[model samples]
Target: MIRSVTMARAVAAALLLLAGAVRADAGATFRAQFGDAFLDRYWALQPDAAIAVGYYRYAARIAVPDAAYRARRLAFLERSIAALRRLPEAGMDAAMRTDGAVLLSQLEQERWSLAEFREWQWNPSLYNVADAFALLLNTPYAPEAERLRTVSQRLTQVPAYYAAARAAIARPVREQVQLAMQQSQGTLDVFGEALERQLAGSALRADERARFLQRLRAARVAVEGYIAFLEALDQRLARDGGGRDFRIGRAAYERLFGYAIQTGVTPDALHARALQEKERLHERMAELADHLWPKYFPDQAPPPERVARIGQLIARLSDNHATPAGFYDEVQALIPRLEDCVRTHQLVDLDPSRPLAVRVTPPYQRGVAMASVNAPGPYDATAKTYFNVTPLDAFTPAQADSFLREYNHWLLQILVIHEAVPGHYVQLVYANKTPSRIKSVFGNGPMIEGWAVYSERMMLESGWDPSPEMELMYSKWLLRVVCNTLLDYGVHVRGMQEDEALRLLRDEAFQSETEARGKWRRAQLSYVQLASYFAGFSAIYDFRESLKQQLGERFDLKKFNDRFLSYGSAPVAVITPLIGAADVSR
Candidate 1:
C-alpha cells in the first residue's frame, strides 16, 4: 500500500509539471502573437488605426509609397505569414488552434490573391481607403480632438492617396472599368465633401484653411485625370466586349467564396437554394395576405388581379396610417414589447453585459439605410449598439403615406424584433464577447445576417404575430430576399440586363419602380452578397430544428445559443467543424 501511494504521487507530480510547462509556453506565445499582430502590417490596413493613430499622433503625416513602401508592404505581409506558419500549433487548445489555422490560411490566401492574382494591378482604386478615412474622421464614436487631428492628417495625405489613385487608373483592365469609374466618382465626392466641411467650420486656423484648399484643388485635378482615364478605358473595353470578360473567374470566385465566407457551396447553388426558400416564403405570405386583406376587399381569386389588388391595398393602408411625427415614437414604444417577447419565448440567453440602443443613421450613410445595426468592433469592451433608422426628408404627401403605412404598430414591432432585442443587437452582443480576434474581425456576414432573418421568423413562429398586417410586411421582406437572390445570380451569371432585372423586382417582389431601380443598381455593384442572408438564415433554421430533434429533452435554447455564439463569427465551414456538425454547412 505504501509503495503504490508513492508511485501514484510521482505520476501526479509529473502530470502537474507537464501541464504547467504547457501553460507557460502558451502564455508566452499568446502574448508574442498578439503583440506582433497589434504592431504588424494588418494594422496598417485597418481603418481604426488610421482613424485613431494615423490622423491623431501622426497628423496624416505618413509618406505615400513610392516603389519602396510598396515593396516593404509586400515583404511585411510575406514575413508575417512565414512567421505565423512557424508558430507552434501543437500545444494550443481547440479554439486557439482553430483561430491560428484560420488566420494562417487567411494570410496565405490574401498574399496569393492580392500579389499573384494581380488584384491590385487590376482594381487599384485608393478611393476605398479614402472612404475609410472619411468615416473614421466623421463618425460620432471618435473623440473631437482625435477627429480634428485625424481629419487634418488625412486631409494632408489626400493629395498623395489621390495621386496614387490616379496613377492606378492609368492602367485599367477592361472588366473592372465600371467599378473603377464608380470608385473614382466616390473618391472625388469624399474629398470634395471633406474640403467643404473643413472650410465651412469656424474652428480652422488660417494655415489649415489654406492647406485644405490646396489639397482640394489637387483632389479635383486627380478626379479629372481619373475621368479622362475612364473615358479612354471605356472606349478600349467597348471594342473587347465592354469589359464583361474581366471578372473573378469561376475558380477564383469559388476560392474567394470559400476563404471569405467559409462555405463550400458554390454561388450558383446558394442562389438556387435562395430561390427555393423564397418561393416557400411567398406561399406563406400569400396565405397570410388572403386571410387579412379579404375583409377590406373580398376576392377569392388567387392570380394576377388578386396579387395586384392586394399590393395596392397594402400601399393604401400604409398611406392611411402614415404619421409624419410618429416614426421615432412608434419605434421607441416597441422596445419593451420586443424584450417581453424574447423573455416569454425564452429563445436564448440574454447577457446582462449586452447594451442596446436605437438611433438615427448618421447623415453621411443615411442614403444606404432602410434600417441597420452597427456592431461593436472586436477590441471594444463596451457593448455599444446602434439601431439606425433613416430620417425622411422632402417626401410628397402621397410618398409619406406609402412610407408611414409600412410602419404601422405591428410592422414596427417586427422591425424591432428584427433589428434589436434578439436579432442583430443580441447576436452581435454575444459576438463581441468572443475571445478570438481573427474570427471577430473577419466575421461571416452570412451568419450575422442569417441569424437576424431567422429571428424574424422565430418570433412569428412563437405566436407573437403582432398583427396580420405586420405578417404581410414580413412576407414582403422575405419576397425581397428571394428577388435579391434572383437578381444577384441573374446579373452575375445569367447576364440579365438592368431593365429586365428591374422588371423581375417589380413583378416578383412587388416593389415600386423607384425601389426596383435602386435594387438593380445595388445588384450590379454587389455580387452574391444578398444571397448570404437567406442562405445563412435557412442553414440556422435547419441547424436549430435538427439539434432540437437530436438533443430531445436535453435541448435548451439558452445553452445552444451560448454554445453556438461562443464560436465567434467564423465562416460556416469553420463554424460547422467547431460545432461538430455537418448540418450548418448545408
Candidate 2:
C-alpha cells in the first residue's frame, strides 16, 4: 500500500511539471500571435512600409491620414506594447527574444515619433507622392495588371489623402513647403513621362487604361492645387518674417538619433567623435596628397603648407572627368572591375546570379542626394538592385563640368564600391538570407550607410589598385563622411549657416564647390541622417577590432564579413551583443 501511494504521488508531480512546461510554451505562442497581430494592424496604418516589405495584402490600399485613425493607432500600439511587456522573457526562445526586442523597439520609437515629433505636421516633403508611386510601378513583383491596379488605386486616393493631410499640418517649415511644391511639379512630370508610358504598355483593357488615365489626370490637378497652396503658405511665412526655421530642434534631433542610430549614445558623443575623425582623416589625406602631388603634377610644385598642398592635390584629382552622356555607361563598365576587386580580395562572397540594374535617377526621386541603391525587398526572393546615378542634364556646360569634377573618375570608382559591390548591395543580399523579418525590414540606417563607407576603406586596405590617386580620393571621401556628420550637427544643433557649412565642406573636407552646395541643401532637407555614416562606421570598426583581438590568428575576414552581414542590419548595439565572441558557430 505504501509503495502504491508513493508511485501515485510521483505520477501526479510528473504530470504537474509537464503541464507547467506546456503552459510556458503556450504563453510564448500567445506572445507571438499578439505580436504578429499588432504588426498587421501597424502595417495597415503604414501601407507604404507594408508594400516595401512585400506585404501584398495591403498593397492596393493607401493609409488615409485620418485624425481619428491616427489616435486609434497610437492607442493600439500602446496597448499592444503593454501586452508584449507582460510576456516574460523566460517564456521566449532565443529567436523570439531577439524578435521581441526588435518589435518592441520599433513600436516604441514609432509611437514616440508620431505622438511627439510629428514630422507629418511640420514637413511638407513627408507627404510627397512620388516615392510612394515609384515603389508601386518599379518593383514588378506582381503581374502587370495587378501592379497597375495598385498604381491606379493610389492615383485615385492621392487627392483625398492630401486633403486629409492638409488638416493635420497646422504649421510647416517654409523651406520644406517650397521644396514640396518644387517636388510636386516633378511628381506630375513622373506621371506624364514615366508612369504614363508604363500604364500604356500594361495588359489592361481599354476601359481600365481609360480609368487609370482619369485618376492620373485627377492626381495631376490635385498636385497642382497643393503646389498653389504651398506657394501661398511660403509667401505668407516670408511676409510674416517666420520663414527662417527648419531645424527639428535639439530635443527631437537627439530622440531621432536614438531611434534611428540605435546606438544608445548621445549626439554630443557622436559630434565629438566626428570632430576628432575629421582631423585624423584630414591628416591622412594631406600625407597621401603630398605623395601624389609630384606623381600627378610633375611640372608644378605642390604648395609648401600642408593645407594648401592637400587642396591642390585633390583639385588635380578632380581633373579627370566623365561627361553626363557617357557617365552612367562608364559606371556600368566599372561595376565589373569593382566585382573583381571584391572577389580577388575575398572581401565577401558574391551570388553571381543576382541581377543589378544601373539607371538614371527619376526626376521626383532627385530631391535628395546624388547616388542611391534600390535593393530588392527581403520577402521577394529574386534580387534586382537598382544603382541610380543622378543626371546632369539641368546644369550648364560650366556647371556640368563642376558636377563631373565633384564626381570625378577615381571618386566615381569609390562610389561604385560604396553602392554596389561589397557595400549596400552585397550587405543587403546577405541580409535577405537572415530569418528575422523585423531586422530585415527595420534595419539600422546608420549601419547601412556606415557599411558602405567602411567598404571604401576596406577596399583600399585590401590593395585596390594600390595607387596614390585612389588612396587620396578615398581619404577625401572619408573626410566628407566625417564632415557630413559634423556639418549636420552644426546646422541643426549649433545653428551653423550656409557659409560655415560651405567652408567646412569645400576648404576643410576638400569637397568641390558643387558638392558643397548640394550638401548644404541636403543638410537643410534632412536631420541626423548624415551623422549615420561616421557614427555607424566607428561602431563597426571598433566591433571588428574586438573580434580581431578575441579571434587572434584564427580571424578570417571573409568569415567575419559574412557572419556580420547575416544579422540582417540590426543596430550595431543589438548585433554586437547578439554576436558574442564566444560563439564561432555559423
lDDT of 1 by residue, 1-586 (tens): 9999999999999998998788668757855865445444466654444333222333344445345655766786688787777767666666767777667667777677656655555554333444445545555555654555556556556557546655644344554566556566656666676557755673667776676577667756766676677767788767754343333455655565565555566777877787787678667766776676667667555446556655765664554443777787677777777788778877777766655677766543433336788766555436356788866664666555555655554566667777887788888777766877667665677788778888888888777876777677777777776777677667766778878887777766776655676577666445557667766776777777877777676666666666677777776556655664332232
Overall lDDT per candidate, in order of appearance: 0.64, 0.81
Residue-level lDDT tens digits of model 2 in 286-389: 78887777787889977778878998887877888898798888889988888888888888989887867899987777767788988766777474678898
Candidate 1: regions farther than 4 A off? 1-31, 34-40, 45-71, 85-90, 116-143, 170-249, 299-340, 343-369, 380-385, 391-416, 576-586
**Relative to the unseen true structure, what is the C-alpha lDDT of residue 568 in candidate 1, on a scale of 0 to 100?**
70
Give the CA lDDT, 0 to 100, for residue 171 in model 2.
Answer: 72
lDDT, residue 573, model 2: 77
lDDT of 2 at 525: 90
